[model samples]
Target: MAILPKLGRAIYVLLGGILFTHLGSYMLLPFFAIILSTEKGLSLGSTGLVLGAGSIAFLTGSLLGGFLSDRFGRRLTMVSGLLIRGAGLLGFIWGATFPALFLTNLVAGVGGGIYAPGAKAGIAALASQGTKTTAFSYRGVAANIGVTMGPLIGTYLHTRSSTLLFGGAAVVYFVLAVSHLLLLERDCIGEDCPKVDRQGIRQIFTDRPFLYFSFVTIFVWALFTQFALSLPLRAAQIESARNIGLIFTASAVLVILLQGTVTRFFTKYLHPLGTMAAGIVLIGTGLGSVALSTSFWHLVASAVVITLGQMFVMPTSDAIVADLAKPEQIGSYFGVAAFVFGAGEAIGNIAGGQLMERAVAIDYLPLPWLLYGALGLLLGGAYYLLRLWQPLAKPLAPVMEERTENNPSPFRPKQKT
Candidate 1:
């Protein structure tokens, strides 16, 4: 195979891995609460608590997994997570009770958390210089494709039996795990990988630019999570699960179609900071329009707009992390990114629930939508300001030869931050 074809093949494996992972996860996610409430005989409040536990576990796992990925290897960490997650899914299918469900969900969440940093770091490690944004864009494409397919398939299976749906999802994860084991290269984990001690780890938390970036991204993620939390409530006019599915599918389709072109356009026409800021602005505008969506088609239009914004934001944010991190610390940086997102989702869920509840009680369905839209705009301004105020970390030099075979230090002196 020619070099480009080889590169494409490698990228495809990575993208396929991500696609299957997301599809499997999404397959179960959208209807999980409903399953708990109806079939599992849990109260809605109890369902929230169970899911919250999973979120907490995910956060904990993300932090720890990052450290391990840097220490042992990304491939090891990622594969272990996938295997654990697959087992968890099977356990969930067999357990048939609240405690079992909760524990299994928590296990799966932890596995997902562990898998995330390593997966993202792998992308950074594999991508060539100057193509990091475009490379990450493909990840977005894969994710959108998975998100589009997973729920539809899950819903179809769900009609037959929840067990079958969950089983199918488990099988998907198992296949993904096998693919990663066979296809993913081990070269990214170099020999002589430097270990970050407690103090060094503390330094990562204290790093101003990274800290700022992570904090800003929290709001961005919170905004994104609103699609799951608040939009459904607003679109209550369309109670058909199929219509809801269509709304989500439309968003993913837009992302699948446009992420690469959007990323490339932003790369060429806009500064990195400007690109991110513009995306945030679009997110806000798209969300603000949700106030006007009183029907299914209106909701679909809003979803498309929101997804367009997402196409711009997701890859750019990821590429920014790639540029900021040192090669070995890529996993840790992505870990922090994942942590921020998880935290955002947790917080957003609670706050959005409150907002929706209060609005419903007051007969003000649009209130939460308005608030979320305003928050997105504020986040956009924050991103712009952060770009101006914080000095971006310089990109690392190309990878050095592996030191594991014999050499002591794989890298030269650290580049000044």
Candidate 2:
């Protein structure tokens, strides 16, 4: 315990560093379909299919990682995941076709997923008095930055060579694995980790708030998944790849700047339920606006609006799970939520590929239609979650109290940014 706080800030930075690598590796994915379709005798849909399979595998691994990390401890879960992920990256280099891609991506997803719960819970475990929100916020900032940089890295690599990109990613994962072994290696879960008795899928199913937030995550991802799949298509149709990229950059910047303060303010002032509602409403409004977007600027405006919502809701949703969880089952709770979103995102991309793009220079309007449908669901689900939240006891000091109780060692790794 004495040595725990000694290297606290350093560990936090390291955790953030690895997360950036994780997101960086896949930055080329949005371009994968376009890159490989011509060379591999694969269609755009085939690229989407392989990527989608990886998402599904990731979702599964997230659930598994969350549950197991609670029991196995963060050090073991994270290290094991890093090693296996390295292996998967090797497979990616050796196996380049659609089937090989799908298989390799699956391994990467699982390895990545297993790391999520441990990373998140581990960070929270380190929070001291009046600073847990700040701690998590810092973690989130690191994650967002990593996620932001990943696309740029991926883009650069794609411009060079696909094989080089995969090979480089594999090396990064290997380096990350070694770094984890060398630094901040904790053998057990933090003293403050949630303790559960026979935690199971059934327990997660019974947690209504968890379920509701999970639903919200799904809709939000499904709605935004367009930028990765359809936005470029739409842009290409309008001959505005630069415009589309700019739109995405603007959104990412907004999120990176405001997310921390937004999350902290809402958590400090509002109920988690209300924060969740605000998120859905803002995202819905943004998505709704996208349907009406005829100009690139309109789409950019929607991105700004929706990202603000994401800033508030996504972190609050995680905190709410932390608030409502039975200490022992925290990992399982978060894992399930991640899995739900992972699965939804997987479906969203694969479906978007088919629904949004045309192969023979044909265009489909499914992008806007799907966005509209997702927006509606977000609105409806927010209402339902709100109603359920009404009868629940609202606490004021879980954040503060948690900080007081867990001070001196909140160096745990958090989930994706």
Candidate 3:
């Protein structure tokens, strides 16, 4: 076997790994609440509490995963999380009740959360200089492919049995876990990945650009979470199964096709903040239109419009992070961004359940749609606030290998902001 083709294959493998794992892991997000509340015979209030248990574990695992990625490097982290998630998914396959699922889901969630940084940092290391935007865009393509496929697995396999569906997923996870551990090279962790200097960890939080951009990610992702909850539930009511499928199909294919192009466009005209606001406003518009949806095509149209906005925004956010992060600290920064996403996912799932399933009646307040809309407004408000100061972190190319009376890690001399 030629070395060059093998290397190319390995890079695609890692990118594919990120996508597949995200597919198996999150395919349940939109349906987990509905499954329990409607299928498993639980009250909405009870179901919310159950899902919350798993999310707590997931977020906790995400934080620990980041710190550990700093200390242990990316490969070990990836192997461990894959196996751990596989086992928890097996639990979901076997576990028969709320109590059983609560622990099992959390276990799987933790495993999934822990592995995210390794995937991202791995890709960062793999890219050649000046290709960071395109590289991250490619990673998004893999991830969306995973997202698109995982749901199909759930939709078809679970018709036979939920246990069989999870069992099948477990098999995929186990095989991928082994392939990753055996095949991937060490250098894929990136130069920054293994270096665990926590000296600037505290200050990364205080960095104005990082902080504001992270907030942008939080809301944009929260809006995306509606795909798992609000939008799907609404679609099931208003749209045909084919139309629902079309929405995601459109989103996935569009993202794969347009993310790189959109990132390049942003390279010239729009900043990350602009991209985020534009994407989010489209999501908000999509969500509001979903509220008005009465037919399948209406929902398909909604997915297309919102996803186009996603193409405009998502890769820009990832590119901006790469641009702003100090060369030595890229792993830690990307890890932090991934962790923020996990945290938002937890909140979005639990809160969405409570709002949509009204008869269980937890609070003395109004309905779920009201809450979802207000939350969207909260996202819009944050976007404007982000607009106040930040503008694309101003990309600095990946050069700087030359010694300037110094070892050319030039961003190092600067004190932490």
Candidate 4:
């Protein structure tokens, strides 16, 4: 409600779309392994492979989506992604064989990949500097809400009918595609549009500072991903599966309720880079604290600390990316961010699994948490040092000036240099 006045209609629409997209995705994607193993009678290894392949497909799709959104337009790219995703979800209805399931997973992954960068770019394009962080924070809240609620609904639907679960997700995506088509405007179009510079695109990969930022991002994601990967495993070992669910549920709820307030405080009091560094440190502290947990309450407390760090990290990271990007290259930058996220998640999954397994083998349960926590602390320190050595690029002033000249608005605040 408070966000409505700060962000315009376009931003509101994008936020709504994000909410539904995550809801639809989490609703079905979380249950894929179960569906594959139980219904299709696939081996655990095969299920893991299918899921792993899907992650690759998603990353590939993110790259493609970024390029396409830059070449064409965000609206077109986003709509196309939704349509593809819808088709992929529809495929689940008849996905009896391994190949069918794998193919559908690939399609769905690509679709999500395509949609994400465009949406992020759209938000950056629509929001002014003053409201950008808030916009992204709101986006996080919406996503958290979806994450919190989707699985609960999915469980019920899953118990009743898998068709309804997958089919409903398909319908959600299809409807989103249509909504995007009707409601969203094309970005980076007409005479004022920047030329598609191939060299500039190449520079994105070579931009040392940007790459460094992305490098830090990978660790951030990897550390954060432990919540999904390692935390649950630890929870199971210590307590029960229900405890695992409660841990995540508490996390989602905390994020949804506190993210905005936390983000606002950080934005008001701290510089963006400072916020990020602090967040990383908090994450490390939280993870490290997990090593000491002997009860469910301790884990919950750790999660709360981690969730606070998350509230700071996620939105600030996005806002920083937006600030660093040229107006024309917003989509491409976000795409790169998505790719980095996938890479980080993969590392988290693999390294976390290995660490967990090794710790268990050695009968030292605290080792993995300590190692992850140390890594997080080191990464956070690295990030802060990098910030000192090479301050992030400022928003492109000339482009902002041009936009202001072309379409002057009293609402647009001057960006700090």
Candidate 5:
């Protein structure tokens, strides 16, 4: 509600695009491994390899997408990414073999990688510093709304036909792509856009604090990936597929309902780094609790705990990245975050699969989750200590001065007095 007044047509459009993209993606992606293992008869390790390959491709795309968005413009980069993603989704319809699935995953991962940073940068470009965090929170809410709905529909469609499920998702991406082409305005123009040269690229990588933050957050992302990588598999062992969808739906619903309130509370009381640390602990606790879960309700409760942690971490992390970035380098900064995301996911997929396989083989189902939980707690503490040692850099007022008549771009560099 507080973020409403800050919403313009462009932001609204971006939010819509995000909502649909996630909806389409979650509809099929959450079940991808299940389909592979059950129907295609791929081993869990093989499935993990396929997924990890995609994540590697995604990281590669993040770098390319970030630079491309900076050089070309957000609108063009987003449109192209969406189209490519749609094509990748369509590929799933015919991907019955492991190699086919791997190739499709690569294509989809690259497309998603390209789209994400551009969209985040577009949000940064449109939002003022005062409203930036709120805007990103709303963006998270929109994506969660999609997450909430996607699994429910996907469950139904999957029961009917895999083709319908994958095809439907492809349609959503294609439609959003068209909408972006028609409605989204270009954010970068003329000299207002920062030229992303070799030096700028190097500067981004060499940013010590930002790199540290990203590195620490990588563990969090690894834990986050378990929702798709390990949780569903765990749930399937104890519950029906429909119930697994319900668990995911419950998590998303909690985020939709509580994200705004949680974000505000944390922002008002805790430093951003503190917020991140606390959120990570909650996530660890939730995932750790999964070892004790025995039924559908128990899984849902654990997911709810995880969602609460996400409410704190997701928006705060995005805002922190935005704050760290120079206005002109927002896309590249988010790109770096995306790269970290991809790396974390890759590690999670490969490692989680092996952990699950070994645990099941040894009849020790709780082993992987307990280990995951411990890692999360340790990383969370490390992050909190890092915060104490070196606080995050606040936005520089002179560097990000507001737009004026002479300075048309909202993010233009301030002139010396």
Candidate 6:
């Protein structure tokens, strides 16, 4: 009971910061496709090339960021990343040229890449035993909050000036940077923290279980990327841009409302492996259902199913990463996972786009979707097998005498006897 307030405060601060960061990021995401095509007069191929550069840079940056987080500290790495991201956003206001835009994306991608591992690792480090899953679920909820609000706000600003929207995102990043530097304590450092020899990407690969998990999740991430890459275009085919936006907003709202309850329910009743597999199956089925959609209502139902699957998998996956990682190497594990995630999304966007083109060319879009759905279900079955081979790892034994009734401040450094 006594620990509740402190735990809640920590969670609130982290969640609040994440919400603002995601809000700023999403505000610009919707503008990218429209701006590149209409304002810059770029062909679809050229637009893809420009966008793909950022994804590549971001994956590279994730590896570097993970190393830095493990070597230095999470708070410092996060603050530095946010500041770099702010500069990238500011660049968009002055540099409207093609080369400038590409450079802006590269810099911003690196910044985002650096921040992710540190932020996720810090959250895991701070979360109490038995609560890491819940903590990550809250993080997902925070993201949904930002996703819901930021684009709506951007839509209004976008009508006035793209410059204004860009500036707004920059300001938000700057504020988040300052807040992180001032408010986030270095819980990932200090004497109480684990002292392990620094390991690199090589060590990450040696952990076969984690490697396998990352491999499977790449396909999962690819499936999720369809929402950004192909789902909108499909929606646009049937409805106006405004209606498509609303459909997305509704999906975010669904996740925001239901993520916590769903996460709790699944975690309580199901094995993490089973829960994740079920979620993946739902995502694939939801996406495949898109082939059958002839109206807005059908797409809406598909989105709900997809969102529910996401609600199940996201938090559980993060928790699984935390569980697999050694406390000191959490950032590294997350970094590797992020790299795989970025790679999957990048591949998904590029491949999914081409597949869509081919499918549309043949006038049989359902073929590609059916194949994707089968892949997802097959992957889920594979994960079940992997779970049997390598059961989830347990928490590390604490270095200090744990606090309870006798010692209330468990987080404080212990004294010499």
Among the numbered candidates, top TM-score falls to 4
Clash pairs, candidate 1, are: 191-404
* Candidate number that wins on lDDT, 1 or 3: 1
lDDT of each: 0.77, 0.65, 0.68, 0.84, 0.81, 0.78
lDDT of 2 by residue, 43-100 (tens): 7788777767777777888888987777777667877877777678678656757888
Query: On residues 323-392, what C-alpha lDDT tens digit does candidate 1 reach at each position?
Result: 7776767788888888998888878787888988998799877888888778878887887776567365
RMSD of each: 7.4, 7.5, 7.8, 5.0, 6.6, 6.8
Ranking by lDDT: 4, 5, 6, 1, 3, 2
In order of appearance, the predictions have TM-scores of: 0.87, 0.78, 0.75, 0.92, 0.83, 0.87
Off by over 4 Å in 5: 1-5, 30-52, 92-104, 155-165, 189-193, 232-242, 291-296, 356-369, 391-417
Model 5, residue 102: distance off in Å is 4.5
Candidate 4 C-alpha error for residue 384, in Å:
1.7
lDDT of 5: 0.81
Model 3: per-residue Cα lDDT at residue 193: 48
Worst 10 residues of 2 by lDDT: 1-10
The sequence of per-residue lDDT tens digits that candidate 4 reaches over residues 212-238 is 889888989998999888888888788
Q: In angstroms, how far off is 358's CA in candidate 6?
A: 2.2
lDDT of 3 by residue, 84-202 (tens): 98999888755667777778878887887777766776666666544555567777777888877878777777677766777878877888889888888764355544456666777
Q: How many backbone clashes can be found in candidate 1? A: 1
lDDT of 6 by residue, 1-417 (tens): 342224466567778878988898888888977887777676788677778777787787787787778777888888888888889878877776678778888998898888888888877878886677778888998998998888888888789888898898989988888888888777555655455464544677888778878888998998888877677777776674457777778888887888778866765555567778899988888888888888888878888888888998898888778878877688888888888888888788878989889988998867767877887788789777775773332221121112122233434466679
Q: After best superposition, candidate 4 residue 331: deviation in angstroms? A: 0.7
lDDT of 4 at 294: 82
Which candidate number maximizes lDDT? 4
On residues 1-417, what C-alpha lDDT tens digit does candidate 5 reach at each position? Answer: 363555688888999988999888778876888987987788999898888877777788888888888988899899989999889988988888889988998998899889999999888878776566667888998998887778778889999988899899888989998999889876666776667777877898888888888989888898888877788888877766566766766677787887777866665556677778888888888889989988877888888888888888898888788888877677888998988887787788878999999999999999988987898789888877776664343442322233123234434465799
